[model samples]
Target: MSAVDVYLADQRAAIPGPSWTRRDLLREAGDHLEDATDAYTAAGYTPTEAEALALRDFGSVDDIAPGFRDTVAIGAARRTAVLLVLVMLPQAFLWDGGIELGASAHSAAPDSGLFHVLDIIIGYVGTAGAIGALVALAVTAIGQRWLRIGRRTARLTAAWSLATAMIVPIIGFTMLTLTGGLTVLLALSALAFMAAPFALVALSAQRTLAAC
Candidate 1:
């Protein structure tokens, strides 16, 4: 391959993040390099010389990769934030269903204080988590455009997402177990409907943290 091609390959190897963002960065860089090469050739430089000049003008991968990495990291963070919001937004309804089921179960039980306490805790924690997810979304989206938000904010957001993802499932399963209605089918269904999406958010958030 040509020197410019080698440089791009090296850049691709150096950066790590979301595939789409990485592809976009490489595509735009390649387009710019092509344009620069063409301009140098029009000035009567040889093909090899034009390629060299274009590569030099484009700057070394080491020099450019940090900025590109930052962009990719931010993109990953935004995705995590969006996922968190999507997952959390529907949680109220899910919690309500769980609460109703728990209420019926608790009504027939001899002692119901633990279920009541767990129910209240879930409601408060879920609301707080939802609000936090919204704030993260806003910071990564709107704040990113208008403010100076960057990796620190992204890291914080990722941490918040991971924490919420972990906390929600633990409390949910505890409540489910306490209700004494937990069955294999119900457990599997909860894992599929509730834990799966939360697991996705957690994975995305973890990736975002690593990228940042």
Candidate 2:
């Protein structure tokens, strides 16, 4: 391979992100290098000499990788934020449905103290999580235009997302089970609606943390 090719390979090795992101970055860098090489070749430089000059101007992997990694982290953070909002916002409906079903199924049963306590806890925790996710989404999307946020902020957002993902679902499941109305259908619904989406958010948050 040519020097430019070698340099690009080194850059690819140094950067970590989703496949699409990595492809775009590498493609842009390659195009730039090709343009630079063509310009130098037109000025009477040999292919090797032009490649050398182009690579020199492009900067080394170590010099540029940190900036690229930061970009990846920010993108991951934005994705995680979006997923969190999407997953958490509609959860109230699911919770309501679950509670209604449980109540109807156990209309003659006395209310358990633990159930009441869990209901309150789930209410407060779920609300807090939804609000926090919305704020994270807003900051990453809109506030970013006016402010500078770094990897640390992205990592923190990911941490919060992961925590909320874990807490809300577990409590919701626990509360439903306490109602003595957890049927196979209800269990499947909870898994599909709550567990699945939260799992997705958790995965995205993990990716964001790794990127950051």
Candidate 3:
């Protein structure tokens, strides 16, 4: 490969992004390198010597790529966080004892000791998972360095938190449905709502991981 081609390839190896994104970034980098090489060649240097000097002045891949990669990662994390908030906020209003079974809201069966116990258990589990997931998203939005967290550790922690955030609500609501407090229509609606967060987060995670 030509020196410019080789240099661009090395840069591509260091950077992590979608194909189009990487192409755009590398094109800008190649333009700078070409401009530097042309300037050196006009000063009487051989093509090879000019290319070498241009690369030397351009900075190493290790020196530049991490910052760019981290920027991309942080942007993805923010988008994911925004999505989670959008999905969860409306659902929070539904978590009250009064569930909508049809056009109107209906309270759960009164004086059911089993329902009370289930509500208490589900409340604790769901709250813990929800809070953990929010904290993880907040940390990711700010970046790992803010809390001295490593990249791998951050990804793993976020993945786990996201999974729990999705699963807990589904479990809690599904159990409520099993108690026969709602009609089939409402139970299905609840299931659909609970599953959305998990599905969306999984897809977001896949995209983020592929970029990384």
Assess every candidate by TM-score: 0.87, 0.88, 0.64
Off by over 4 Å in 2: 97-110
Q: Count the backbone clashes (under 3 Å) in each candidate.
A: 0, 0, 0
lDDT of 3 at 95: 60
Give the per-residue Cα lDDT of candidate 3 at 159: 67
Rank by lDDT, highest first. 2, 1, 3
- Which residue runs does candidate 3 get wrong by more than 4 Å? 1-6, 13-51, 60-71, 97-118, 142-150, 181-184, 209-212
Instruction: Output the better candidate (2/3) by TM-score.
Output: 2
Deviation (Å) of 151 in candidate 3: 1.1
The positional error of residue 99 in candidate 3, measured at the CA in angstroms, is 7.8
Candidate 1's TM-score: 0.87
**Model 3, 72-183: lDDT tens per residue?**
5555555555566566555546665245443343435446676677667766766665565576577776656667543454365446546755566666665666566676
Better of 2 and 3 by lDDT: 2
What lDDT does the true structure give each of the candidates?
Answer: 0.82, 0.82, 0.65
Which candidate do you rate higher for TM-score, 1 or 3?
A: 1
Q: Give the Å shift of residue 24 in candidate 3.
A: 7.0
Give lDDT tens digits, candidate 2, residues 1-212. 99988988888888776656667888999999999999999999999999999988988889988887777777788888899889987787655755554454452233888878877888888888888888888887787899888687789889999999999888887877766778887787788889999999999989888777
